[model samples]
Target chain A: MAEENLKGLMLPVVIGKLLAPLPLFPLQFILSRMVRGIAQRRPEFFARLGSHIDSSYAIDVTELPFVLLLKPNPRNPELTAHRRPDKVASDASIAGPFMELFKVLDGRGDSDAMFFSGNLKVSGNTEAAVCLRYALDDLEGSVIEDLLHMGGPALMPAHLLLQRLRRLEMQA
Target chain B: MNTQAITPNAKPELVCPAGTPAALRAAVDSGADAVYCGLANETNARNFAGLNFTPDLLEQGIAYARGRGTKVLLAVNSFATAPRTQLWFDAVDTAARLGVDAVIVADIGVASYAAEHHPQLRLHLSVQAGASSPEAIRYYCSEFNVKRVVLPRILTVTEIAAIHREIPCEIEAFVFGNIGMMSEGRCSLTNYVTGTSTNMDGVCSPANAVHYMDLPDGSKTAGLGDFEIDCFAAGEHAGYPTICKGRYLSPVRKEPYYAFEEPVSLNLSSLLPDLIAAGVTALKIEGRQRSRSYVQAVVSAYRRAVDDIAAGRWHDLSGLVALTEGGKETQGAFQTKKWR
Candidate 1:
């Protein structure tokens, strides 16, 4: 189990290292389009957030150089990447490694377990963050899994493939 | 009295939980014999913001679960405050109207209302009812026609066996998840700070009142309302600041200690046979605030465990301890008489 967790930690850490020095504009453009796409595709999911539908969220991947500012606005959602320490106003902020946050979004990992384990940290309006967690939790299918399939256009495929192999090793 | 018989069924019912329609569906699909949930109101004990179901969604959930051979139990469990008693009545009316298999109720007033009005609806006493003895259990059975009494989590198996031999109604015991100090329906610990409670308002340390913040020295503290209940250094496990589970500072203790109860979950996997021996007619997993994955994982695990035990086998389920608060699990006064 420990080996598998370490292996799961590797891809995101390695990816963060690889992408750290890269320019942010293209990534920001991809994020914006994906955010709008999600808003269009999953309006009902966003609606489940209830009063927090328009709440701003900061997804700070501690291992990465940039953070994501997201507003799950029902009409016009926004997700943008910005450099860390260059603050973005948000109603709530969830900081964690990329993989753990991805796991929480997809329901593969328990957010309570993550939060208690100190793997996932939340600050500023914890209720809003919790509401977001529930909304993501009840999402019909894994959002990150869906995004991975979409992201597998290249690097993500290799990374996830390695993770799956490590899981197989653990089972063995 | 339809005591449901004291013969004890060949296998205990596996009662699971769901906070939303999706979780209800997942619980049913994961092989829950019965799935329990509540309305998006104070009538539900887990009245978290954005959790539980609106009546319309509950209708959908019932339709889906019933179609899949799963019983949907409606929880109208929170105590009804004065003048607001009608809300609880309306919830019972909604349950009867929705054709739920049973209504788990905590308040005697709510149970009486359900018994008088929705006479056709099956009534299961909620654990919040805190029926731990034959006398209380029989009172509910005689007065409200309660078919099952969910025992408080404070009973030892031997004590339960003793009660089981005397009670006329079926026995339901909590087998997993949070264990309180067993003060159910009367504990004012959370209300002292948050001004809300499980029995009255169907919430403990309500999300709006619970906060987590980081300190300057890189420690995280969990607070309920205005009180900082517990603090954790890095890598230390943290739990929600529900007053019962929160640690506190006392001048008597050198350092902080669990002044109320430690944040540990109850896991009764190893005691399943013992619970059956004690004539537990059903096993309840208590987690309505959890996600679909949680429902699926726990329900599926217990489903397999119960089926295996029925087929004359047993397997280790200690892995489930990892899902608990502070990564700790206790039998919680089930095997032993020890609990906070």
Candidate 2:
């Protein structure tokens, strides 16, 4: 009963409160940096992704205020934020709740199930979506950990806070 | 029961898994009679990223396997969704064009397409087709001109012999690797949890829906989507978050138990002779998701075992236990009916 109550009350309230005031541009910039850092750390990942996906992809965190537009440039791969969500037209767009997107990026969740259950939505080019799925599936480690490592001492608190929130959500 | 032992003259073919080109080479070099692989798309079941062969890799792998007197079977086994049937059709066309020994397929439509368009290309019914009975087998053989049927890992040696006696096609049985309890191609548990259909998408309990969290008391919880699948104690090796193998608390049972199937591998080394005598033409080892070293080790062990069985030698296969899933192995449903 307590668990049920917590589930009904805590999740939406917490997620809304945490994500509401987050500056979209700054967050998107940080995420772009994180992607760049990931590419630096694991060049093979980006290379494989580029080889498979030659188009632009928009990754929208459905619950969040930002969208990450990535172009798999084999020569120069980069992830950028769309200033206006409506402005950037991608070959493919994958939209899902923030945590679900994180789970996929971190190689921790099953994209198929999330997509099947309607938590994750894919639109436009199916081939691009498949390529992205394959690329993400091929990844071996945690995207969150890599981001935290890149953040260094400054983002340790944020990492801890995120962990705590995840724990709480799981408990609920 | 046929008490007569299989003669030393008859040797069943050893079909091995090749997820990559290197693994295909390793399998062929290690004494595999035939190696099976899929393309880097949803055409095959093991469609994990970085795994499976690309078109170029498949061509190279086929060349390598064929040069060494080994046959290569292409798995275009995933069910074709209504709108996306072209993918399956294209895969068949490619396999036929490349001259693979056989095209293993599951969906009826895909099988029909292969049979109609490419009569020269031999068709094998994938286990995902779930054609266990003689009637189903006959239908596939007659309709699709299926030369062989990869039997699901649910039949006993006796049942297999019975099916073999009744059916016109050669029988291929899984001899080792992760054992699935659910009816092949019919399971939707993973689909319920994750939006992807295993039959259509060619992936089950895909990595994206899997998450592991460290608990406060040093325990680890593995979750699939929102539900906690299993919680392991410290020092325990947590298996992948596949829904069928997960332990759960049932309404009838107070404590958590393996409600569906336990996480154990199927190692039929001891029953190689029995299977051969039962008219099993080929022995398949599962795991395209496994590493190359794993493919080498398992294939080598099974090769020696098959040879020993053919040579009328008593083979001890206990060494393979260490290489099995969770370091545990079972004969599965080959010996007994009460395998649940």
Candidate 3:
């Protein structure tokens, strides 16, 4: 996709304003359960991180209302949300559009390809981000599938968001 | 009457790299004749934090490959330190016990131990062994019964053919991957600061000591330990921070330049026919530390090239440029001597 096409997918001002007052509890609850399921599915995912198992990652979707903070602590894996103004104490940050980052997570695309194409921007601890990419690359299952299945009614808004993404992709 | 006879050489084995179980499957599915991997220890050269396989994972990978008639070569290629001789020996023993097709070894001590303890195991000399000459190659073949030798990435195609004519064992050459200017199994220059070597400890610049900081001027700085590798402009492709590959200053030159070598991947794709004619037994794809996507793309591309050569079909492997380091590639000393 073109740079402008992807950049345009960032949450518009109107949507951001609408989601500003929305409670994060439902999304947090859904994410917590998804993390539990993912942890159970791929137990070695965290173990694969080696020394970076303790490091936290900020998975940012450009223009999105909230960013995801993931800590693959094998004992107690954590995946929480942090909106703007809430500082994310992360070791590394990987920022891209939702679909771009989504492609990497679901194994449709790779970090190297995404990075080289200038779609994804990685900052902060380079090594830790690399370890995370290595771990994620080794994932055989789909993270999107895990999320979609976990969220029933709570995922309706997310489902609508996916439809919007698809339309934008079609327009491109 | 003038007549030239043309008989294509037998198809050389396509040895793909496997960083993880997923990568192993990707290789096998993509028409690899063999897949090489190392255990998740200091046993292999690519000892990155999250790379390599566990014994259980290896077992699964081996099983998956075996079902598809793809051979598995386990690499216990790192030097066996005095304190950790048992670890290398145990790795060799595991290879034998697991029924691996062969074990790639570099260190003489490790080879001797494998030959002594596991006489039934097949030993392939790793490039890290630095067995470049016929004498060195012969010595290894005689002492350790090495079936094949992965020639270092520093030899010209003519030199490879010359070595092949002289050596008793089969020859394996690197067809594509990172172009290391330093000698194989000797990742030492700036390693004194890091207290590790990719050849032994399996880390060049250890991950924990690496740092990347964004500058106020829209440039980025990469630091490995106390040494700052390079400062890249905002849009420049940021490479991995290995000191030797980093640009540096000098008294004579106006600007800092790549003293060692640039980050160009070794791509010997166009020389597939020359390699086959030269009696190369196998073609190894480097990057066991790279992702499964890399494994899949590279292996499949080479697979088509090799197969096209066999079936007498048109082949274009130029699309693989996207996968190479910084989108730049070199045949690296394969076609000509880069060093005097």
Candidate 4:
């Protein structure tokens, strides 16, 4: 009877371990979809954010790591809104170009049409934002596209599950 | 601008440091061909209390330097984050409007702005930019029309020679003052301990955070935040207690050792001829926060050495012993890679 009980428990554990990474795909998909939804609703919010970024300004962003927004001016578009994920803060503002820029970046996984459409914004000073967008789009369209495309939407959960299964395999 | 083709002079420029109006005059009168200083704020790296000059003082300093055939370069080298970028922008605008010779800059954003707004003004890449590689140097030069690049302290004389061969602009190396082992423009160890950041804020071991305690055993203890930097014997020299330069106790060794560098000043007087032969265009003496006396002495000694070498005289300047840090000096990386 004990042997039978152990076998039954073992089957579920094995199955659960095998299916663990499966959920990560759906989770990422949902997150990406939600981000897309937000981007579709508000395009101008992220567009105007860069106008306010100053060199001496310090923002305490809670939702994201404390990244130096580094808005040099509303004129130069070459400066991208780089986010240093290591230094996140809580009290920082979420309005302007940052909102839409991050949203479009987050949702790029959903659909190309969503990205190509006016759904994504290069807000603030459009000339400067366009320059920043071109740089990012070029970089993304080049070497990085392979990785993002290979993963598709399903890569997220598969990656998570693979990590867990690999750990189990190591133990076994 | 002089459009005529001119042969290069063997005597390089004598770049000096000035903190206040008095220091500026002292540097120029004592024979500084050029003096670099900043306004009294975080816009400059030497953001010390009661140091630097005001806008009025800066105008006077420029006039004084011009009158003495000495050029003045305004340093707005500190990195500006956000909201505070206006200060840097305004500083650059004011410097250009005042007909300053050049503005020493390190921040990419600041450089970009200066290039766009003030095309007539010449730009010199500050040491804080950390453009050690030829590629990096080229990028700055091509992007901002940088006339000169201040090589960082980490590169050896050989490396400097190699870089000089590749670049078209003038190369200025630090001949005297602090020898920073840590990477410039990226260090945050001091900021982690103290609120003031070395890269962005331009102030390291800011006075507000430093505390010194005189111990009973004829030793002094320097503390930053909760950590003790070093405990110096009363007779031993008490130096600037920075995190990287501080003595530490490790599990492998019980005795305290200088993990980075011993508190010593970099004096390259012995390597002047070698540096000149290496194609260095100018010699810069650091310490804008230092007093006029310090500036006068260091500048005078270097000026004499540079002039003597140009005049084809056999000069030995090792007599500048008292002016060194802890009365000890090194050739830094200029002589040999291994300083020992």
Candidate 5:
């Protein structure tokens, strides 16, 4: 009787934990699709990045627990999403907490300042890392806005929801 | 005290830092009398990744600076271990071969080798040598033919004047930038935390070992290795978590405080006249790790200041406050010891 009562009491906690991470799947899928669209639209940008990065590179959101593996193909760069931590590897990797990486990608943060203050870290080929940074700095448009535009009218609500959730997470 | 009348002609050479080829050009274009840079190797003190000049780049930079009538000084300033002495030797040789104006070196072994092998190449004692005293300065000058000694930023104007009277070599002192409170070349705090020697590896508080954690309460904590070096509250500008510049909690203190040094830049602009009068021949502006824009801004400001001082005019230093670290500046032992 006591065991049955305890299981009943703990059931909501277990369900809540399981449901929390479900939202991240769609968020990751949308982010990956957006990145692909951006790369496809800006082949020249990707080509410039490819010139600096001769091999596969990885971007890991340390806080979000997601990795985006990028293989620069010169003409059509390939970006793969690796939600599973065990499957991610690349020639070089830049890792930082999600907000910091977001600020960098959105052109709101200074990469040198972030790196100097220990908020960002790079491993593997440093030359390739530097090249990637330079390429990113030279990118012309906002990938997030581009993604939102490509998402069409239906996904705007979903994007707003994601933004709200992100805000909540930051507050938490 | 010899209150001798001002010579009106002895303008101290304005030395500037250049981490990249573009920065070298920027320094020269902005009227740097001399620009100091290091090869893209561990020989230089500021050996951050993507920074420093390649051998080819250094050659080109030397040519460029020479074209503008600016001198180029190659820094092979890091200490060499017993096994890695060849790298230092090669750097000195390359500097000489490239016809650099001077090779700034810190290691005694490297200095001795440069003195023996390349007698014609001018040698400047790096601040890393920490040769602050008259005896130490004389030893380096007598043995190594060191033409100038970059004095460590620990002495007052009075002390510097005294040293200038005693030493045969010219005195070069840092006029602006980061102030290292610890004895130069002797600091092992970074090695203690990160297991990489700053003097040997030419990296202090290396980026690889540094990590920042954003907390739930909107505060940020900077960690070096397993230790939490500092924590910043929301809206506070976070500084690079070098161990010496970290904030810590003490039993007697109510709040966390910078135990050793704060995140303030050394701005000796107000004391330039005093320093020049004290017989400092070269005034160095530190920051080989900074950007070209920073190089241009700082070099331009100091160039104007130096020219104005030479012309017996008041120097306007208010413009440089924006470029200083943490938006704060200090004279750092130049004005007073009360800062301690």
Candidate 6:
């Protein structure tokens, strides 16, 4: 194959692969940050949303080894925008009094960020870790962004953009 | 402008959890103004073994409590599904028929139904409802006419004060027992593993699936299905393994860590005055599955605390530490948000 022809094909293919995640990347980024902001600033909203979580019967998150628990403050439930932290834990290592102690000590006993920093530990399962992380990421990004945008300009777009970048990484 | 004429008693009511008929009587007799309990079925959050009141027993329990000037709050505080909606509905109806003071509900559908159909019945929002903010509380109050809210185990005294300032309904907060770190209304940990959701089914770590094995190391391992929730060393109290309270291994650190939470009780005895100042109406004790003796002891201690506070007396509640999970207790979200 000629060098010119090969280069053209490779560029398009590479561009196709690279740009594929672009739209979603920006969206995910914005969404994730929006979730962060909401998690940090507007916990009451998160708590309210959590209270209304779909209760369909399924698997138990407690059984998983790694759990990334994230919810807005229960006292104030206002769906807001921004990136929020998570409460990350391994199921095997931390479960009861330890998790409670960590929560009370972190000064964010109710904040979702405690789970992400490994203050709370899960013990046995690894898939739980991944799923919990992804679930939290998704909640921060997709749920907050969508809900805020639908709700009103009470949400900041530029703020969400920065948050998106912080939450989601561009594919290398 | 007779501001003092209202004279509202802001003294926090000791809300005790009654897992059985006997526990109910113990709580009521021990100076508990309000006693909360769930049904025998998985419709309540504490769906543990050898706990909760049957419909017949609930009637007797309510009568017993009411006759003693104690209020009975029936906790139907769990999720209801399409298939199980009837059970929850029936529970509510039965609670109303049994002359209970209020029915604690978490589900939107259930709340709406109770509000609409049982216009005369009083509805209290469950912590499982997770209605934490002023707006959310207001929404429930306006929409469903919910009279009181069992606030989640998350909130500083200042935060509670702020919320109390804005909301109109009565506020109840947990003062002792299992401090659920997860958002009460939205958590789905139970359903994710055992195919049963606490939010919907009102059960966490359902009994049939929970198993315990005494390991050779003098530590007992508790499991749900094939998953190991926790391993307790001998001489240390081993709580039944629930997913939220399970132990886990962290990749960042090789040591096993409590991923979700530990078995710690939130004892806010030191903050009783602060809670009273916050205009709280009730202080809840979280143990419906506890023994009657446990109920009596905890309730009596809390009752004394409430009276002492009201009488302008100050005493340390640290003496009750042995009653807490792992023989430890913390202020929960009442202090700073230092959740480590």
Write down the lDDT of every candidate, Cα atoms only: 0.83, 0.79, 0.83, 0.67, 0.79, 0.65
Candidate 2 Cα misplacement greater than 4 A, ranges: A1-172, B1-9
**Candidate 1 C-alpha lDDT tens digits along B178-284:** 88876777788888898887678988888888789887887899998889989998768888888877778888888888877889988999888878878888999
Cα error of candidate 6 at position B110, Å: 1.0
Tens digits of per-residue lDDT, candidate 5, B1-340, equal 2223346557899999987776788899999999999986789888765567767878999999999999999999999998889999999999999999999999999999999999999999999999999999999999999999999888898999999999999999998888876588899999999898889888787756776666788677888888899997766667667899899999999999999889899999988889998999999999887656677889999999888888777778788877777778999887776767
**Residue by residue across B212-320, what tens digits does model 6's lDDT show?**
5656775667788668888777655666567888888777988777888877788888887777777788889987765555677789999887777776766657777
The DockQ ranking, best first, is: 1, 3, 5, 2, 6, 4
lDDT by residue (A1-172, candidate 5, tens digit) is: 5655454334434544554466566755665676678777655455444445456788876644456788766544567666655677686788776566665555444565566555676666544665566455434345555667788998788577446534543443
True contacts kept of 6: 0.00
Instruction: Please give the lDDT score at residue A140 for candidate 1.
Output: 74
TM-score of 3: 0.92
State the RMSD for candidate 1: 4.0
TM-score of each: 0.91, 0.69, 0.92, 0.64, 0.73, 0.64
Segments of candidate 6 deviating more than 4 angstroms: A1-172, B1-8
Write model 4 residue lDDT over A1-172, tens digit each, in one string: 5655454335435653554445344544543444343334332222323333232222222233222343323233112222444443222222222223332343222111122222221112322332233223212222222333455786677455444433432343
User: What docking grade applies to model 1?
Assistant: medium
Q: Which lDDT tens digits does candidate 6 get at residues A1-172?
A: 2654444334434533554444444544554455465556534223222323221111112322222233323333122222222333323222332223322322213212232222333334422332232223212223434445544675577356435432222210
Q: What total of clashing residue pairs does each candidate reach?
A: 0, 13, 0, 35, 0, 104
Q: What lDDT score is found at residue B121 in candidate 4?
A: 93
Alpha-carbon RMSD to native, per candidate: 4.0, 11.7, 3.1, 24.9, 10.7, 24.6
Please identify model 5 stretches exceeding 4 Å from their true place: A1-172, B1-9
lDDT of 1 at B151: 89
- How much lDDT does candidate 4 score? 0.67
Retained true contacts (fraction), each candidate: 0.55, 0.03, 0.49, 0.00, 0.06, 0.00
Q: Supply DockQ values for each candidate.
A: 0.59, 0.04, 0.55, 0.01, 0.07, 0.01
Per-residue error (Å), model 3, residue B73: 1.1
Per-residue CA lDDT of model 1 for A84-135, tens digit only, reads 7797899899998776676665556677777878888888887788888877
